[model samples]
Target: MILEIAQLQVKPEQSADFEAAFAQAQRIIAAMPGYLGHELQRCVEQAGHYMLLVRWRTLDDHQVGFRQSAQYQEWRALLHHFYDPFPTVLHYEQVAL
Candidate 1:
């Protein structure tokens, strides 16, 4: 499986709003084909920071399948603007576990 780890640094006072928007946003992603599962986490050290951990059947499932789908637009509309300086999303694969 391909694992995607997205780190989001939200604006100071926008955390609550961002989370609310993401509640709807997650449903869109979860409906997409090839979606395995995901977890969302808030950073303890950085209050406004968040992380999205998702697993896919393959890299293309995320880079192409999900991103190209219309649901992604809704996801972006809801969550993209809440980002402060934007975030870097990286993907990896299981090596040992």
Candidate 2:
């Protein structure tokens, strides 16, 4: 599985709106191909900061399948405006032990 992590920093007073938008946006992502699951977590010390974790079957599932789909436009419209400097998204894979 591929793990996608995004450190989201919203504008100071727009956290609530950001969360509300994300609630709507999540459905779009959840319906994409190869999507496994996702979670959004708020920072304890930073009110406008959040961590988004998403599991995909492969990196292409997120980068190409989702990002290239028309649904991405809706996702962007719903949640992109709340960002400040914009979030950096990275993908990871489990290390065998």
- Each prediction's total of clashing residue pairs, residues at least 3 apart in sequence or on different chains, is 0, 0
* TM per candidate: 0.96, 0.97
lDDT, candidate 1, 22-96, per-residue tens: 898989889888899999999889979999999999999999999987888889999999897888999999889
Off by over 4 Å in 2: none
Top candidate, metric lDDT: 2
TM-score of candidate 2 relative to the true fold: 0.97
Indicate the residue-level lDDT of 62 in model 1: 94
Tens digits of per-residue lDDT for model 2, 16-39: 889989999999999999999999
Candidate 1 has a TM-score of 0.96
Clashing pairs in 2: none
Clashes of 2: 0
